[model samples]
Target: MSSRFRHAALVGKYQARGIQGPLEEIAQFLVRQGLDVSLERDTALNTGITDYNALTHAEMGRECDIAIVVGGDGTMLGSARQLAQFGLPLVGINQGRLGFITDVPIGHFADALAPMIAGDYEEERRTMLEGGVWRDERLIFDGFGVNDVVVSRGPTSSMIELKVTIGDEFVGNFRADGLIVASPTGSTAYALSAGGPILHPGIAAWVMAPIAPHDLSNRPIVLPDVGRISIEVAQGRDASVNFDMQGMASLLPGDRITVARSSHQVRFLHPLGWSYYATLRRKLHWNTGV
Candidate 1:
């Protein structure tokens, strides 16, 4: 049978040692399935693989029908962010420890991917965070957050004070080590570790969790993914804000970081019958006592 995807982009964790063998194998497997394969430019350069065509993010976005990301969730996060603008669908193969989005195992990649290439899979859309730092009503820095946006203190041993506002309404003052603004997709990420509840991907919501607050009353709150949420650095030295993998450090006291749902959503292709609960159980070891 002919593959649904005419071309596939292979993105790998370029920093991983001995990644070339698996990458080459996957590329060959895709080719055998009657699909053309190309390597992401950096992956080809870093891994020293020249067999397939090397394409930039833009080139891949324009040419490839699907992207196969090989690495941990971090690698997937990077690829998703870069390719999200093109509205491309991604498939993740787990080469790292925790495979949240990268659910396909490296050992069983052939078994899991063959059918997916033939358009036999489930597609899930995940939202992202779009945010920026405003200083004196002027936009300073802006970026995208796949997991969560963090506002934290710098090299000082003091907790930063943040003024939280949800769509022009004053929430409260929080004095904490930091603050995390996570999407439903990010609920299982840093926010989960910071005591935030797990939010189902089907829900269109965001979770705001305090990081070691001075007052115990400051707790995690789930907010609807509507309107803009503003967090201002009320008081702190060298406060900073992070948009998932990217961040701006040494922010001023009056800097306000405005976060809202991004217009673009990332599409992830999963194997048939893939369940969120099953992933949570396996990754978090929730089935241990059950």
Candidate 2:
């Protein structure tokens, strides 16, 4: 039987060591499956693989039916942010420590992906956050966040002060090492480390977790995604704001970072019988009870 994905685009973490082997293997596997394969520009350049066509992100967006990303969650996050705009469905191959997004094991890629390429897979949609920084009421930087947007203190020992507001209402003035504005997809990331609640992907909410606040009373809060979240740097020597992997440092006072729901959502293809709870159990070691 022929696969629905005739043309596949492969993306990888080119900076990581020992990635060329897997890239070559996957490319060969895809080609053997009777599909035309293209390597992402940088992935091809860095890996020095010239057997297949090298395409830019824009070209892949226009040409390929689906993208197979090989890396950890960080790599998937970066690719998802860039490819989400094109409505491209993605399949992730785990190469990092934690395979939250990259659920497919490197050894089991052929087993899991063979069926998926033939249109026998579960489809999942994940929402993204899109917003920007406002300096003196002027928009400066804007980007998408597949996980979360964070505002934290710089190298100085002093904590940052952030005035939080949800839409028209003022939340509070928090003094902490930093503040995390996370989507449901990010609940298990940095937010979880900061004591934020784990929100299911089906939930349309955001988690606001403060990084080590001065007052213990300030706790992690889950809010609806309907309103825009604004975090203004009230007081801090040097602060920074990060939208997932992209960020701007050395933010001055009065720099407002506004976040809201993005119109585009990432589409992921998982092997048949895949479950969010099952993923949580395996990844979090929930089933390894004593």
Candidate 3:
């Protein structure tokens, strides 16, 4: 059996326009539950709490039993990248629209925590991707992504050309605006908008989707998680790589980017009543009463 987490850390994007209220409520809720709650410095200031340990992102991941993200999916994505290897479960409280990763609504926060504290909920382990930027055979940037890694043209020129290969098999050369290498957890983000299929979270696969492919026949392809993908920039003045929306190293012509599944996984907490399809309907507004 897995161990239960007793110390909970609260993290939020306090500078994100308006998030102070929810952060305070979550912090108070955790304290009320008798759980040890530590707040990020910015969040603590926003909540008028001063006797708190001001932790950096990495410190929060290392010290916390579980991390509670009280912002949009963007905030959750940033936190996940830092916390993935820490093996701590994360619970996201939605403060933004269409929160695929930030699953819990603000109103349901208390209800969700009830069972989570008692260890009555399930942990969903999600796969992550490790990407390396190689410039002239020298490794430049090594990073990981919980959602998707995007390669796109920078401020300078025209469309980019990318030659992709998967596990020693040449996939195709794509001439397009960009490319998205996504995990099943990220299928609903950029990949979904790029006409990529939605993959179930349990699937151990990655979706390679080309954005605005010049050839209509060159569609998104899903491959085994264990497969290694190499993307070479054939022609482009300025191209760049981003991991889970966080900008990484810039790529020039002839740069090669390799991506594969990372052995590390991230644990996410879901309330016993949480359902993926239900979140889809609520966030997507699938149906409305007449």
Candidate 4:
């Protein structure tokens, strides 16, 4: 084990069959290497491992120097919110389709494990968005979003009117499906489907993309991540702000949603040879037509 890291935490998708055997193997390997390891409670129970079991992500976070998530980006996203507070370096062992965030391949994790345990890895700091819905002049919903925050007419097939502004400047009123406020990490998600530009992870930027605008002139835009993005539900029937595709809070007419880059920065550890462009190319199949 590296001097910088003495303990590690294992987190993965709940009830995922492909991960259990690897989880058992990894836990035993870490123990043999003389490094402390904790398993996320549900994962531990699912895998039948008893050592260093943690009931909560917070417990694992406080006790571990590094966290290795063993599933897809969705699992990583869920883990990010809970474990980000502890500021530990996080990595992943991919066990899901299209593992954008979880870049490590389980087939070669054994080869990489020794170097990783020795602190031979690279880390990138990814920014998250602090989003909230303000109703009656106070925060009604608040959370950290690793990807995009969406405001829309929830469960309805009709369009809604939304007034959007960034940093005290008036943008316009958009009558459409909804608006997507995305961090750089989210540029590939819903924002991408809405014609938003792909932003490099190192870029200090965010994107404002309209889901389906009535006016085609209303285009997707990129903005500095430093300021406030305000979205007001001008005309809608029980609209809501969905954070990271996880939870939603209702928004009445005249309710405002604000999003900005959070002060909390989460670090993702990558194996030494990992490349962002390589991941994009492989996942997107950009070379297929050639």
Candidate 5:
């Protein structure tokens, strides 16, 4: 069978001596296979590979048919946000400590590259959340969260109040350290640490977890990923709504944010024999009941 992807781009942690070997290996592998290959600017500079073409992040997204991300999940998260709009497919080679989204092992990935290029792989379409904040009818914060969108206190180090509504239904006024609206992809992230359930990535759902609620009775809830989630913060103190801990926007009393499933989704490619259960077992230590 012929290769499914022609132009490929390599994006990795922007450091030398760390990913240089694997980066150069994959670049040369694709080159010998006759598939066009390029590198993200920092990846090229850090790896000291002068022969292949280099593209800026934007250029890479617009140009490449596939992006082979060679870092931890953080690298993939950043890339996913940038390329999700372009609808680019990402294949990860785990160089991170915890490989949730970045699953493919380094040595194993090198071997699978050829077959993956030949269209022998599985594609996972993961859902994303799009959120925007409104201040007196003016839009302020606009961004996408792959994991969770949080509304919480800033430098004050005290609890804040948030009035929440889910699809016209009033949930409650939450008084807590913070609140996290986690996508199923986010269930394993902050939401999980906050005592929230892990919804399977394939499931279409969101989890609303309160971070240290003043009332123990206030609990996390899983809701369908439909309609809009509205959160209005109470006034008199400093607060912000954080997106993936990557972006944040200040909020005032009565300012609100509405989060909904984005129309766009991120496509992740895995080599033929990928298993989510295995990943969870390895990452979370499933069987060792200590």
Candidate 6:
């Protein structure tokens, strides 16, 4: 379905390592297009663009017809969880090293946006995972992650032993630095670093990879999105559950966390001429030497 509002919401991290310059340019360019632009309050204040409307991250999803993110994939992933269920399509401008989600570069920002504004873009639906933490039968934290939910030992702790079960079947006990339950969109992030396979974004599966496992036989495993995953800290000095690197909750010696496919999905806007493989090649320096 087409959008109903002409207004667009702008979200980004101008404070990222090397992003301020391009962010300023994009913000100014959006204003020059005669479009009604909305910005996060802090961003609006930092950039000194007072005339624009201010909205919280989630509120922006409700107010704007489309949302534009001006940072790298991490920034986009964070914003996507907040805006995904709103059914607002996201346009990401690459301002960091790996532009997986933010595929549009600074040079082509204008060209890409013009067509997008006119509704000439493709929408790709990406999966998300929802997790909940329980302690003493009390619900502690519940949230969704676009990428992965990681359960790891805290600082100064040895490797953790975690018991994993899927659909009432015992998976196995994992003895590792941590465990990563990643969506297809996240296979290239921490999971890839731990030797997990890169999953195509359109795939409807998740990967469970044990980080720095004590046993080499514990390899990464792919699971269908329909099943439920239960992970308990069978034994550990100290451990924690992290959601997309944003939210964290403490895990005592015997805490268990359950992860399942979220009913909500994130929609990404891919303007004409954008290619995911091209992004991988560029970011990874695949052909730099040749």
lDDT string, candidate 4, 1-290, tens digits:
24556888888786787667788787788778778888888887777767566667777777788888888889898888777778988888888898888888877777777788788887799999997888889987888999989997777548899998888999899999899999889999889999999999999998899988999999999888988999999998867788888666567888999998888888898888889998899999987988
The estimated TM-scores of all candidates read: 0.98, 0.97, 0.93, 0.94, 0.93, 0.93
Error of model 6, residue 265, in angstroms: 0.9
Candidate 5 residues lying further than 4 Å off, grouped into runs, are 1-3, 15-17, 45-48
> What local distance difference test score does each model get?
0.94, 0.93, 0.84, 0.85, 0.87, 0.84
- Residue-wise C-alpha lDDT for candidate 5, range 232-272, written one tens digit per residue: 98743678887787766467888998999999899999888
What does candidate 2 score in Cα RMSD to the true structure? Answer: 1.5
lDDT per residue as tens, model 2, 1-290: 33488999999999999999999999999988888999999999998999999999889999999999999999999999989999999999999998888999999999999898988898889999999999989998999999999999998659989999999999899999999999999999999999999999999999999999999999999999997999999999779989995999889999999999999999988999999999999999999965
- For residues 1-290, write the lDDT of model 3, one tens digit per residue: 24566778888877776577777677788877777788866677765656556676677777788899988898888788888877878989888877988888888899887678767776788999998999899998888899998999877668899999888899788999899999998998899999999888899898999988888998998888887899999998678898887766458878989999998898888888778787778766786773
Error of 2 at 146 (Å): 0.6
Query: Candidate 6, which segments miss by more than 4 Å at Cα?
Result: 1-5, 17-24, 288-290
Off by over 4 Å in 4: 1-4, 45-48
Ten residues in sequence with the least summed lDDT for candidate 3:
45-54
What lDDT does candidate 5 reach at residue 198? 95
Q: Is candidate 3 or candidate 4 better by lDDT?
A: 4
Per residue, candidate 6 scores C-alpha lDDT tens digits across 73-142 of: 8889878988888887888888777778888886789988877777788788999999888777777888
Q: What is the C-alpha RMSD of each candidate to the true structure, in Å?
A: 1.4, 1.5, 2.1, 1.8, 2.1, 2.1
lDDT score of residue 228 within candidate 3: 89
Candidate 5 local accuracy as lDDT? 0.87
- Against the true structure, candidate 3 has what lDDT? 0.84
